[model samples]
Target: MRKIAILAVGFAPNQSEITETISLLISLSEFKAQFKIFAFDRSTPLNHHELYDLESLNPKDFDALVLPGGIGNATHLSTWSNDKIKMTVNPTVEKIIKQFYEESKPIGAICMAPIVVAKVLAKHNPNITLGENFSETHLVEGWKVTVEKCPSTDYITCRDTKVITTPAYMNDATPFQVFTGIRGLTKELVEMA
Candidate 1:
């Protein structure tokens, strides 16, 4: 049994974090049956099987940590540029991440979740820019239904210097790209355990 941690925040991009997290967790079944999914925000929706707080979580107990995609992950759980001041992730989560790093634990973050990864890297190197690509719009039927851009880092750093990131979306105008996918980390992260 391997313990895995998944953070869920409130008010995120539809199908971003939830879909990705569920997919990653399901894929983990190939490795182990025991899992601990943690939802950080009180407003977050939860499955009966998932846990609800960081207070009870011990980084040592888990073999790996996964951060999923979402606007919430971008804006709240990662670095945010605001009014010339750069802000980073929730303090508690950051602390846990630092601990995970010290122990050389595997981490998987997708989409905006990488911003947190960038910050973690900065703590040591401070020279890495978590590159973000703009102009990636969600278009459909030749109509730009939604404009999507990562205002922060998309590649998250993990133990052994692993970085997992993606830029995926579905629509007629916004065609899919192979680089914009999530399953790649499923194999990498789960295999670490």
Candidate 2:
């Protein structure tokens, strides 16, 4: 089974629903995957879901890394909430992203979650998006990434960085459209893995 690490790094309750949606879709796919939902802080669990401490996560153990949607990730896992251009990504989050990136492993981000990845891998300048006219387009300014406006049910997969991104709630999309976009993310991620 392929091992996929889903970062439950945000504080928003809806973030869990998005992550669970990704998990369920992946579970129903043909590729068999074992997931580890990691917590940035073990002391406070989100929605009572037990999370594996992120400090103990080893990038070498997983085939792919997933970052869930919700702007909460930008606020919590990264400093994007306050400093959009000069934001700083969490050390552990940065480490994992770099490791998976250096290893050429797949990394998937949903909605605003791509902000953290784009910030961490700024020098690499990969492509990502949060739909057209994203309210926070200013955040991508100094990140050095090429931002594209993909459809709500579509995703952008950077072949060079192995980074897959989708605009889930980032766009004014329906639940079905969000699920479709995430499903595309999972299918592409597993193929890359």
Candidate 3:
């Protein structure tokens, strides 16, 4: 079975992060993949499955890596502003990402998580999307729900980098749409493996 390492950036994080990780997990469950949650925090939601600390994980052990969005404050941990401060993604995460890339393993990112990946692999110039149409608000009946801008059920892959990304909740998409996009990303990531 192929092993996948999932990092929740800052704990199973918020609702979005939890949902995103679970969504990815559910998607990957349909394949021949075994996964472990690599949380930034010391504690994670307890379950029959075991958890590992991100700092202690080695990229060599996992076939692929997945990072789900929900990094509200942890976003400050990464710096993509310029090359001078290229020391982003914290040391552990940076090393993990670089090692995966070096070994030609696939990596997947969803929603705002792509920023972290792009920032870490700035030199690679990864092709990613955070769900477009942010310029317009989605208006619906009953409530003023912002117009749903898409790329919802679609994903982007950086062929050279072997990195896959999708716009999960980035466009305020529905859970079904988010899951669809995530499933697509997971499919591509597993294929690359």
Candidate 4:
């Protein structure tokens, strides 16, 4: 089984972002895949949440990395808040992303999570999608990423790197649409693996 590392926010995370991808990956008959979740906050102990401390693990252990999008991603993965205009990406999360990039491992990012990808891969100017929101599209473009508007059921793969992205709930999509987006993201990552 291939192990994929999923990065999530420590606070109230969007459950669907993580659950849908995981469920679809497990249901695949073509390949067996397993996932390990890591959180941005290291101080919080794991409980009902299946998250492990991201700082404690080596990026080398996983074949690929996944970033699920949610409001928490803006709050925790980066320094963005509801009231803040300027945001700083978290150093720890940035470091992990850099490690994955250096290793040439496939990365799957969804919705607002592409913001983190854009921040880390600014030099590459990776082509990605974040749904149809014009404001969010401009936000990522400011970081030097090439934004492609895509439907919630589809995804965009960067040409220069092994990064795949999808717009989950960012499109005001139904649950089924979000699930299809995640499933497409997972399939692309698995193919890269």
Candidate 5:
């Protein structure tokens, strides 16, 4: 079985983190072996919700990296700082995420997760535009690029690159509806692995 990692930062009362967990699980169910979840907490704080810091875990053990979207990641990742207040765990997660990308492993980000990818790339290569507008809640900013056989409203996948973005409301969907897009990606991930 292929070992996969679903990376998360904070699970504070936010729609992005909650839906992202649901989306990751729903996607994993279609595969033979579910991914191992790792939550990262530099503060060593307790997460009322589990899987709050999945990204902070070591990436060497997994075949691919999955990032869940949220405003916390976007704001923390884009900015650089030495101050403790501004330098939170999410930024650390972003740095690790860059390492994952540099390793050339498959990464899956849904909804605003793509924003994390955009943010990292923006620091160096600002040429890539996600869309025209920016969202405070979701943290999506750039021209949207979609793929075939993916959810229209809540999901987009970079099939060639093995990166995915899901809608904010994806987890609210019925089980049948939720797995459609994720299953497709699962197949791709497994095949590539």
Candidate 6:
């Protein structure tokens, strides 16, 4: 079975993105893929949610990495002191992503999560999508990466790297559309694995 590690915000994450992605992957019983959730340490115990500490995980143990989209992604995953200011990329997340990239493992990002990917893989200048938004697109382009515009029903897979991205809620897509796109993303990542 292929092992996949999913990164989520330590605080309130996009529950829909995480749950739906896991559900779709689980539905694909034939793929024989196993998944686990990891979050950064907030210096407090997670009482309501069960997640492995991101620091404790070894990227080598997983076949692929997944980043689900949500408001928390921008606030919790990256090194942002406030909504208007981003200091640096999270070292742990950056290290994990770089390890996966160096290993040629696939990485998937959804919605606003692509911003984190763009920062982590800045030198690669990977082609990604975060739906059709002026500001978000501009932010990604600032990283020297190309941001492809995709409909809610479709996803963008980077040509030069094994990075996949979907707009998800960024386009205000219907739940059905988001599910279809995520399923497609999952299938692509599984194939890469």
In order of appearance, the predictions have TM-scores of 0.68, 0.89, 0.81, 0.85, 0.61, 0.85
Which candidate number has the best lDDT?
2
Models ranked on TM-score: 2, 4, 6, 3, 1, 5
In model 6, the worst 10-residue window by lDDT is: 11-20
- In model 6, pairs of residues that clash are none
Badly placed stretches (over 4 Å) of model 2 are 10-30, 43-49
**Candidate 2 lDDT (Cα, 0 to 1):** 0.78
Model 6 per-residue lDDT at 149: 88
- Model 1, poorest ten-residue lDDT window? 138-147
Residue-level lDDT of model 4, residues 16-72, one tens digit each, is: 245444444453334567777787654554344477887865889999898877777
Q: Which runs in model 3 stand beyond 4 Å of their true positions? A: 10-16, 72-87, 134-150
Q: What lDDT tens digits, residue by residue, belong to model 5 across residues 59-137?
A: 7877887765555454444332232223233556667677766776777765445555655543333222222233332
Q: Tell me model 6's lDDT, rounded to 2 decimals.
A: 0.75
Please rank every candidate by lDDT, starting with the best: 2, 4, 6, 3, 1, 5
Model 1 TM-score? Answer: 0.68
The local distance difference test score of each candidate is 0.52, 0.78, 0.71, 0.75, 0.51, 0.75
> What digit string (tens of lDDT, one per residue) describes model 6 on residues 1-193?
8888888765444332554444344534446777777866444434544678889778889999988777666666775425433446778888988999999999998887788888888899999887876464665677788889887678899867899988878886787888777778888888888
Better of 1 and 6 by TM-score: 6
How many steric clashes does model 5 contain? Answer: 13
The most accurate candidate by TM-score is 2
Where model 1 places Cα greater than 4 Å from the true spot, the runs are: 10-16, 79-85, 125-132, 135-159, 168-180
Which lDDT value does model 4 have at 24?
A: 44
Model 4 quality (TM-score):
0.85
